[model samples]
Target: MNTSEYGKVAAHTLKLRVEGMDCGACALKIESALKRLPGVSDINVNFGTEMLALNHDAGRTSRQVIEDKIRNLGYTPRPAAAEIAIPIDTGRQEDRPWWQTRKSRLVLITAALLAVAFGVAWVAPSLSFYAYVAAALVGLVPIARRALAGAMSGTPFSIETLMSVAAAGAITIGAAEEAAVVIFLFAVGELLENVAAGRARAGIKALIGLVPRVAQIEQDGEIRQVPVEQLRVGDVAVVRPGDRVPSDGEIIEGLSELDEAPVTGESVPLSKTVGALVYAGSINGNGTLRISITKTAADNTIARIIHLVENAQASKAPTARFIDNFAAYYTPASMAAAVLIIVVPPLIFGADWETWIYRGLATLLIACPCALVISTPAAIASGLAAGARRVLLVKGGAALETLGKITAVAFDKTGTLTVGKPEVTDVAAIEGDEDDMLAKAAAVEQGSSHPLGLAIIAAARSRGLAIPQTFGGASAVPGKAVVARLRDGFVSVGSPRHASELNLLPDTLSDQVQKLEGEGKTVVIVATKDLALGLLALRDEPRPDAAAGIRDLKALGLQTIMLTGDNRRTGQAIANVLGLDVRAELLPDAKLDAIAQLKAHGPVAMVGDGINDAPALAASSVGIAMGGGTDVALETADAALLSNRVGGVAELVVLARATLSNIRQNIVIALGLKAIFLMTTLLGISSLWMAILADTGATVLVTANALRLLRVRPTTAASPGESA
Candidate 1:
């Protein structure tokens, strides 16, 4: 029975590494070849990462067929291998670096061909044609053969086909030297491009290689070497000093300083002890550790980070998408223009067909748009990869672009600009004993998730007040208060707003609420059925980095605003510390309106972390979530800081601007060279060989320029004028 008869072709998607793609045109060729297969549905080829993501019917066409099709298109496809990264200062060695791979061999062979062709032409002019042909055959044979194979398999419009046709045309016109130079130079450019592309793709691979493949696991009181994949949750692992943690887990014993640079970009090694969480790949220092694994190898923090960074590289910016769309039509139009140049000029004006036809072939060689197509993605990929290493995850090219333009950044006060942790600042009990009332309020706040509620519980516990184990439902909304059922009556503990909504607080008690609130503290009321027992005041302090970060943004001339649901005094206090424009007493929907209003002034970014911030985050020009561990924040924001560093925002802004500047430089170099060469070729002043070199040289130059972004690191000088 046929495979399809036995089983319906199961709809499936496959992600694989595609090797030997030279340019954006090569990516297009791979995509065009694979999509023609019987079962293939979608083909996405990313030249920046050299990855092909495809969706196809499994039974109708096997994976082998897809691989073979790609091979016929002059590329190689393989299943993605497991991730690996070599740790710094470790005794173990890593796999051979990218420069030592096939790319090096290609560069060497092409350089030899270039030397032979130029040497023979200068030394013996008579045999120069044959020598050039020999070099062309040697250098162009692989590309020419691939084009022939593609032609035999009914593939069309590939860069290989275009180059092969142009070379054959030149040889026919006694221009074999030009043809040989074109082939040799093209090879050189592509190899250099391969190095650049490989550098960008290596970021995640380098991250993966940081962790040890085999870890020391404690099983039944014995330490045994085991692969990390085999280690399950709850497995205790023994991590010695000068070793890396095997997975995300809590330390059950021992103490150490953990270097978390690989995971969160933290430069300082953090002190860790029992019950402290240690992430996979963090280097242990000075002391051994017995860690209880909380996540498997696949679900560890390192894996999650790698996955997000890879996804960020895959997503295209608006400019990249537009370039792709433009190139799709550009190639076909060039073919048409080539035909018109050859036939129209000779037939209508009685021009020499040989010279005009040669010009037409040269035009086709110039028209592939390889350099133009890659202009944005190359820069964007480099920027994204570098940002990932610095703890900033710009989700896509669009976000990176938007981030560069943000003139005003609206900050959510509670968890973004300030530390989310709150503490009890003051307490006033009007009717009952302050200690008894605080204890009852703390009991009602038991197991509560709110920062203010946790503060009350913590304050009571620290003062030796006994808290009951259980509590009833909240008296008002979820964030407002906590209510506990009692023998006499229910006791409710919530914000002053809850009391005002219920009309339970007396006017005299209201005065006390205002007085406490005036001191920049959040006031809460603890009440029985009729009378108020007391008022509790809590305050969340701004992060130490908050003032510095805001100062830096302001120094850069960015308009800053603090948006919060906290009352005027509380919000103003935090804003004043950061020296920001303040917007207070705004609920979730009101926050969305505030974001819209800010957008009207200029491009605006919203910095937030919470469920309520989601709507405003979506409404802003760019939504930057703090420490994207929260599901809602991760889903809503376009960018995330992996660590709880408010200063990451400033780093992201600088990086984004640098990326935009790099992108502009690449575009100028790519299009400017193309324009100059196009004019020269059309005017018959530049030979076909020169045109090809110009295209190749421009690609190399732009790529090298874009790589400059990789050097603009976080916590360093990213720009010339860093603001006074």
Candidate 2:
């Protein structure tokens, strides 16, 4: 399944960790350079936050290409940096230390001073305009310094420059009070936006902070602490309980569970027996272990997540790119419309110049399109936050949007549809009683280490069947079965076909065994020397939520398909039980191909939980990996199931549908309000106060409406009846 097929246009997205962003001016400079790049449609740079978002066409540019451009623009890119800093200590002040984050304090001070002047103007009506003019002249010092600095450097505009222009224009019109009010309010909003952006950056900061500060390594059986950055490849590190793993590596010794939720978003503690791979940033839960560093910090999982998010932000969706293109011309077009509304109406209809000029100004304010600019990102941020709570980490809005449109969901059967482990499914006795059959099988297979043997032993334990203490010298006969001298006689348990080769006579249960085998269930034959005693059927249990999940998908109008490495009969049987429409059987490669085939029907999503499924998951429109499964699966999937519930896939779809609906509604409301404001402004019926109210009010409305998703609850009721 090609993700690019979901939309008509595909562009390359690159994430670059930016350095040296200290203020809005620095952010603006980087934004300008990025926008100058050939295919970049939009660039949003927050200097108070060290991040750059870019969207370009893949065919025209690559990740490295963009990094080169950023380098040329005098900024450092993430991948090529020698050392990456993990954000430590979240909720700290932005742009600088707490004392240095004085933007808000300065703005408040300036506003208070201006308020005093405004009070004087109000007390003396005659001085109302002049007193505020004096205040504007006082405020112009900082604004002029900023504008002159930009002008001297060849850059013509800054936020301060814009503020000076608006202020100068206000003073010329004897609206000094209005000018002061505008500048003060603008400063306050800028300060607030800086604070909000700071808070958003904190999430990533906490994530980066996970990069271990130090490592404890063992050399010659002696342990020593070393800076994590100084650690190199092949270094043997000792990780104590409750400590974060210093680097990505494999466990060499010890066994205990580890909490990797911080990195993988899987809240459950994963068992870490010897030889299990441990990742950097995962907390060791009561386990002392040694690991050889396999990857550098740059290649670590946490670093990669940071890179993914940064790149995702830089990248633009097709819709977003289209909007940007529209805006380039749209803003100028709106300006012309406002001019025409003022000039042509007064010239042709003999309207008062004041009335028409006010009409033009109203049109200008109405045409700023703040509602359109702010709604989408705010909604996305809120939705992403809500998803993170459930442990569903959507890297960006595009993937979140794609998940909702999934019309067909294809699953990799082994670890996704069924539990990764096998267990005894059915037990039937012929001439021998059920108890005797199970006992004989367990006694003979007690020493075997095969998965089948372990399964049988587990089944016997579950049924309270005991193996003889001295089932003397049980031996596995390679190609045949397991045999041992039980108290009664030499008992054997193996495949029925293998049992036949051992000269065991078929009993009445043989027919039943054949019938069960035909249903794709594995039948293990239990026998004494002469005749077949009974049959034990074994199969992996379908996950408790698998069927319900499939049912939910079908209810949402999504076609469900199951792909497996099992045989046709086994696949068909499981698909039948789950009411799935499509079942493909074969190798992992076949599953990948099957996913590709399914995509021709519509946008396809592949779900899986094993390393083998990684490629297919990556190949799909959206890869949904079971979180509790393989690391490869989790890293490759677009979204992960935190609870590892198959039903969570359905729930995700429901969430996506809700989010999309909300976005559409938001767009409608914003656009509708903007249209009405435009008509009112053209008719000379709107005031600046009304324009501000409409613009800000529409923003608040859209924001609140988008946030409705925060209160979204998965329907307690299931999707209406639809077949999988």
Q: Compare the candidates by TM-score and give the number of the best one.
A: 1
Report how far off residue 638 is in candidate 1 (Å): 1.9
Give a tens-digit lDDT track for model 1, residues 1-724: 1135557655677877777664666776677677667877767777765667777777688788888888876676666644432212222112345455555665667668768877987998888889878877777778788888666655455566778888888888888888877887777777787776666666767777877889999888899999888889999999999999998899999989999987777788999999998888899999999999998887787777776766776778898888888887887888888889889989999999888888888878777677887788878888888887776888888999999889999999877887788888787888878898898888777767777888998999899987655435445557666788654578889778888888978898899888877768788899886768988888897887888888778766789899999888889888877788999999888898988888898899999884558778889999988863434434558888767677788788888888888888888887788778778887899898787866678888877777777777656223423221
Residue clash pairs of candidate 2: 12-58, 15-311, 53-314, 54-314, 86-208, 87-208, 87-209
> lDDT per residue, candidate 2, 1-724, as tens digits?
1126667446654544564343334454456555655666656663423666566776666667667655544345553233653533233345365335555665765687688887887788788788778777776666566556544443343444445654675576566776666556554544544454455455555667777789999878899999877778888998989899988888988887888877655667999887788878889888788898887666666666555555444444444445545654665576678679768978998988766765565556556554565455545544554554444556666777788787799888888888878888887887668876887787777777887888888888888987775445887777677888877778878788887776674656567777787766888888877877878898877898788888888888898888777788878878887889655556767777888888887788888884667778887898888754234544667777645778878777777777777777767876788788777766656654355445445656666675566555553118421111
- Model 1: runs farther than 4 Å from truth? 1-9, 82-126, 148-155, 339-354, 424-516, 522-537, 601-603, 610-612, 628-636, 714-724
TM-score of each model, paired residue for residue: 0.81, 0.76
lDDT of 2 at 124: 88
lDDT leader? 1
lDDT for predicted candidate 1 compared with the true structure: 0.78
Which ten residues in a row are the worst by lDDT in model 2?
Answer: 715-724
